[model samples]
Target: MTVLQWTATLVGLSFALYIGIAIWSRARSTSEFYVAGKGVHPLANGMATAADWMSAASFISMAGIISFLGYDGSVYLMGWTGGYVLLALLLAPYLRKFGAFTVPDFVGERYYSQTARVVAVICAIFVSFTYVAGQMRGVGIVFSRFLEIDIALGVVIGMGIVFFYAVLGGMKGITYTQVAQYCVLIFAYTVPAIFLSMLITGIPIPQIGLGAAEQETGTFLLDRLNGLHEELGFAAYTDGTKSMLDVLAITAALMVGTAGLPHVIIRFYTVPRVRDARISVGWALVFIALLYTAAPAVAVFARTNLLNTVTDAPYAEMPDWFTKWEATGLISFEDHNGDGLIQYVGADAVDGTGQPVRNELTIDRDIMVLANPEIARLPNWVVGLVAAGGLAAALSTAAGLLLVLSAAISHDLLKRNWRPDISEKGELIAARVSAGVAVIVAGYLGINPPGFVAEVVAFAFGLAAASFFPVIILGIFSKRLNREGAIAGMLSGITLTAAYIVYFKFVNPAANVAENWWFGISPEGIGALGMTVNFAVAGIVSRFTPVPAGKEGRDPAEVRELVERIRVPRGSGEAHEVSG
Candidate 1:
């Protein structure tokens, strides 16, 4: 079968499976919608969590970033992975024990203030929308290429599919669906890596193939790639370009941001017990390791394959895959010197005859992973499978983020704050309605995103780190943390971070470089500074303010007791219900 045929067949089957699962596990109550009735098995929950946590940024864009950025991209690898461990060890179980439906719920109850809940709800919505924009863009990219539709139309179609399962089944549906998505995405990701590894290095394992010598030249792959890069006036593949301070700040922001994500934290609430949450986190780490370890290998393989095939090639002799991607407007060529040959070079590059030539080709980084198999002349079925995998990675995270948005609006804003007398059934209807609206908004963002998939996602993580991380951590560990302090911290942190990102990314794009960055921190790393400001502001405010009550009209000692209980895990079947 051709690539299109294979893609349609595989994508159709996957969509059917997802729709069926949603129908089978549709939520009937608010509990089911919000937390799947808190009955998910640890193993299944682990798979679902992995699927939720590894967004399109991981499956589709991380390798692409690494392929182009080289050693500077390691920050993403370290930050995202390390952040998961931080979440698992420090936050997941405790949050599960708290028994809140959303992060806002936890904040409102823990801090005993409706205003705090409202602030948290706003933060969750802001962060979620920013993150979901990337997922929707991922969907559009896959459909635009494989289905040969316009990106805007593809986003609309993806929005429709997500709306069906997310609105009808809620967390109950999304959880089981994510388990199947995990299977599809992981298989799709690894099979192509294995094929390309053997094709390039005569080794079946991609991880080993990364360092193994090439079959034809008997030179190590990394060494060959370095030579190619330097020959083309690009930095050596193994060399780092980012400063140490920027790297550290970006890594720290991503790490803390991961621990504070509302979507990932909500997954722990779906499991049966705190013990199950901990165990599920363990299983999730193992599942996550599979793709994380192979990413650098895949990056190396794709980069090597791309450079070998395209550099200095004639435009008339380009492959079918190149033309197909070119039609999507992702890859373009211009005859700057009227030579009719592609000069895919870096800054200030000189030709073979020592003549300075401009780069004549522009390729989008997000296409590298999706186009890797095709570029390597792999089977049609492999390309199709990757298309499906990218969709799975994207859709799974979109559903999770949409749910967070819905819960924040319906549960946090309306039911808890505005209309306390609202019925459970009414709340369920509200959740679905809000989620539907969110899907449409998300589609709009996808069609008109501010940046590429990974870059937009990095901004979302920065927002989460600056706004949510400090508040969540202090809420859990500090008994003196009052609602005023939490609200102030969230507001100040998110404001500073968002302002910095906007100023550099939008207001002054020319000065986005390192020289103009405040204290050598780029917009991506400014979240760390914002987080520090949050901690300082919250600590100072709490020190000056009077000690607040744990609950309305309750004694102050109970606040200390509340923090103590969150720190310790009770036995199975113990009192797990936290009073709201």
Candidate 2:
């Protein structure tokens, strides 16, 4: 079959499977809708968590970013993986033991204030929306290319798929569907890596192939890539352009933000026991490692392949893949010198004839991974598989984030705060309705995204770091932290981070360069600063404020006891189920 036919078959089959699963595992109560009835097996939950955690950013954009940015992209690899470690070690078990349906639930109960819950709810919704926008856009990109449709229409179709499962079955359906998605995405991701590795390096294992010598050139793969980069006036593949301080700040923000993401944190709440939560974390790390370890190799393979095929090539003689992508407007070339040869070079670059000329190519970074197989002349079926994988990765995360948004609005805002007497059935309906609305909003954002998939996702992580990480950490570890401090910290941290990002990204795009950044920290890394501000403000305010002595909050002694209990692990008892 042709590539288009293969893509439609694979994508249609996957969507059908997802819809079937949703019908089979439809949530009957709020418990099932919110946390899969708190009965998921560790291994299944691990796969589901991996699928949810590895969004479109991880599957489609991470390798793409690394391909273009070279060594500067290591921040994403380090920060995101390290952040999962932080979540598993420092946050997961405690939050799971707290028996809450959502992050805001923990904050509301721990801080003993509806006000804190409301703030957390708002933060969760905002961060989730920001993150989901990237996923939806990724879906649009894949559909626009493989399905041969407009990106806006692709996003609408994707929204319909997510709405069916996410609204119908909630966490229960999303969890199982994510498990299937994990299998599809991992298979799709690895198969191409193996093929590229063998084609380029004569090694089937991508991890080892990345360091091996090229089949034709005999030089090391990275060294060859570096030579190509320098020959084209680009930075060396191994040498990064970002300063050490900025790298440190970006890494820290992503790490903290990963631990604080509402969608990821909520995964732990689906298990049957606290030990199962920890076990699921371990299992998730193992599953996540499969793709993470292959991403760098994929980046190297895709980058080397792209530069060789495109640079100084004839536009009329370009491959079929080039024209397909060009039609989508993600790749374009202009004849600056009227020579008809593609001048795909960096600034101040000289052509093959040794004449200095302007760069005449514009390629979107997000296209690297999607176009990799075609660039390497891989099989049509493999290309189709990747299209399916990209959709799976994007839709799985979109479903998870939408669930977080819906739960924040329905459970935290309505059931807990505004309508304490709301019935469980009413809350469930509201949750489904909210998810439907969120799908429409997410589709619109996808049609008009703020930036590329990875950049938008990084901004969302910054928001989560600024708003949620400190408060959640303090709520778990500090007994004296009251509603005032928690509320103050969240509001101040997120506000500062949001305003800085908006000013740089939207308000003053011309001044977004490093010279204009405060303390040389870019908007992406500013979340670390915001997190520090949160910690500082919470600490200072908690010190001068009156301690809770059973007056307007939980008893001071009880709060301390609660902290100690969460710190110490209990036996493998049944999971504590929170009432609706």
lDDT of 1 by residue, 1-580 (tens): 9999999999999999999999999999999999999999999999999999899999999999999999999899999999999998889888887788999988887777788889999999999999999999999999999999999999999999999999999999999999999999999999999999999999999889998999989999999999999989899999998999999999999999999899999999998888899899999999999999999999999999999998879999999999999999999999898888888999958866888979889999999999999999999999999999999999999999999999999999999888889999999999999999999999999999988898999899999999889888888889888877888899999999999999999998998999999889889888888899999998888888878854552344765677788878777543256564
Per-residue accuracy of model 2 over 1-580 as CA lDDT, tens digit each: 9889999999999999999999999999998999999999999999999999999999999999999999999899999999999999999998888878999988887887778889999999889999999999999999999999999999999999999999999999999999999999999999999999999999999999999999998999999999998888888989999988899999999999999999999999999889999999999999999999999999999999998998889999999999999989899898988988887777757757888878889999898889999999999999999999999999999999999999999999999878889989999999999999999999999999999999999999999999999999998888888888999999999999999999999999999999999888989898999999999998888888878655433455765676777767688665544334
Worst 10 contiguous positions by lDDT, candidate 1: 550-559
**Global lDDT of model 1:** 0.92
Query: Which lDDT values do the candidates have, in the order given?
Result: 0.92, 0.92
Pairs of colliding residues, candidate 2: none
| Candidate 1 collision pairs | none
User: What TM-score, to 2 decimals, does candidate 2 have?
Assistant: 0.98
TM-score of 1: 0.98
Q: How much is the lDDT of residue 110 in candidate 1? A: 75
lDDT of 2 at 43: 98
RMSD of 1: 1.3
Each prediction's TM-score versus the true structure: 0.98, 0.98
